[model samples]
Target: MSTLIAIAITTGILSGLWGWVAVSLGLLSWAGFLGCTTYFASPTDGLKGIGLSIATNLSGVFWAMVIIKLSSMVSLEIIGYVITAIVAFFMCAQAKKNWLNFIPGTFIGSCATFASNGNWQLVIPSLILGVVFAYAMKTSGLWLKEKLEADKLVEVRKN
Candidate 1:
């Protein structure tokens, strides 16, 4: 598990670095991508954020493409958005890796991209950063827990 996690982090770091390069070169917009990435990357014990973010973002990309292609078929714009939301919800609810958190993850990824002018390219890096940072957050929490427990042990011994 540790080795797999380390690899995941390494992959995210490499992808995020490339995203930075793209931003610096003016090849991409950094605003929405970075913002969404940071918000979703919040670290926790089980890396749930990263998992959910990845799944949601990937689905968001697909939905964005579909909406772009299909929205014109409908006379009502709101219907298109509703259709998207329903499909997104269904997908999120079905995701096995993140079934528990699928709702927020799907909404965040889909709505964020939907609002970002349907730029899945920009969404990719944000997803990477979000996933990697989630790992970092989990690791930090574990380390902090260990240190606090050690401190309690020391205090008990001194008494």
Candidate 2:
């Protein structure tokens, strides 16, 4: 199975399991973010992919809180774009290495903050939980793949 598909299934289960929790804690609100981040971060850099995503998730949440707080001082409807640009620029500047796709991943995580109406307190926890779940889902997927497809390549090539 594809890693992304496995992630989707894992998070869906988690979401259904956590429906009683608030939006911020529910996987339904975060599975997409986690899947996209894992997809972009897992392409290369091997073990470092998870580390890169961890940093991106945390940074994304922090920038989100910054934007949300700034929303109180100005028009988020407009200033939100400006803040997004600045944050994107800042994140891209430091992403010259394996994390070149970090911007999109962070955007996914950061946007979750506003969507959930979450505060800074949830940033660290959310990021941490996301990273942990993403990793666990990925590893479990690889294990399942190896176990089930021990003899088949199972590679899907599109031309």
Candidate 3:
């Protein structure tokens, strides 16, 4: 089977499993999906992707909190926008560091935080869980593909 097909199968299976686990644990399923998506979108694969996803996503959460806190301190609605803009600048600027270079991951994290109304307690764990799922999906899919290929080769040899 193709690598793509293997990944698709694993992703579908994992999504269902994750959904059930998330609900059982009272965690946000969507937040976990966001983290999983962030992992796949990462520039690198394997452990690097996991690290980048976690780092960038958490950084986004931090920035979102800053925006919320600073904006809330003022009466002007424009202050919120201004704070967001400033935070955005730092988000992108932080890309100078290799680990934090995934700008989209940061944005996704920030959006997830905002969506959760800055509930770091729930969102943080959900995001990290999602990254773990992504890693499992990728690794398992690749392993499945390899196993299938090996089986096919053995059959061909016997034939």
Candidate 4:
């Protein structure tokens, strides 16, 4: 099988499994899917991608929480916008760190948190699980492709 085909199969299967698991656990599957997408979209692959995805994702959640808390403390409508601007600056600035360099991951995480109404409880697990699923899908797909190639090579040698 082709590498793309293998990856597609794994992604499809894992996506279904993740959906079922998320619904069973009462968590938002879409949030998990966002994390998975972020992982795949990350510049680096393997453990580096996982680290970048998780770190940036959590940072986004933290920033969102800060915005929520600060917004609650004040009544001015503009304060929310100001707070978000500051947080956005920090989010981008945090890329100086190697693990938190994925700026898009942070944005995705922040959006997920906001969508969940700042429910870190649900967002955290969902994103982390999604990253894990992405890793599994990638790893398994690669393995499957390699196995198929090896089998093909052996057949060629016999002929």
Give the best candidate by TM-score.
Answer: 3
TM-score of each: 0.56, 0.61, 0.98, 0.96
Where does candidate 4 have its weakest 10-residue lDDT segment? 63-72
| 2 against 3, candidate with superior TM-score | 3
Query: Which regions of candidate 3 fall more than 4 Å away from where they truly are?
Result: none
The top-ranked prediction according to lDDT is 3
lDDT on C-alpha atoms for all candidate structures: 0.58, 0.60, 0.95, 0.93
Q: Can you write out model 4's per-residue Cα lDDT over 1-159, one digit (the tens) per residue?
A: 888999999899989999999999998899999999889999999998898899889998998899889988889989889988998999999999888889999999999999999999999999999999999999999998999899999999999
Give one digit per residue, the lDDT tens place, for model 3 in 27-93.
Answer: 9999999999999999999999999999999998999999988999999998889888888999999
lDDT of 2 by residue, 1-159 (tens): 676676567656654543344364544435444533554465553357666776666667777777767667775478877876786677667566565456666666676666768654654555555555556556666666665565454443321
User: Model 4 misses residue 116 by how many Å?
Assistant: 0.4
Model 4 TM-score on a 0 to 1 scale: 0.96
lDDT tens string, model 1, 28-64? 4343344345434433335455555566656656766
**Model 3 reaches what TM-score against the true structure?**
0.98
Badly placed stretches (over 4 Å) of model 1 are 1-49, 72-101
Which scores higher on lDDT, 2 or 4?
Answer: 4
Segments of candidate 2 deviating more than 4 angstroms: 1-41, 74-84, 97-101, 149-159
lDDT of model 4 at position 79: 88
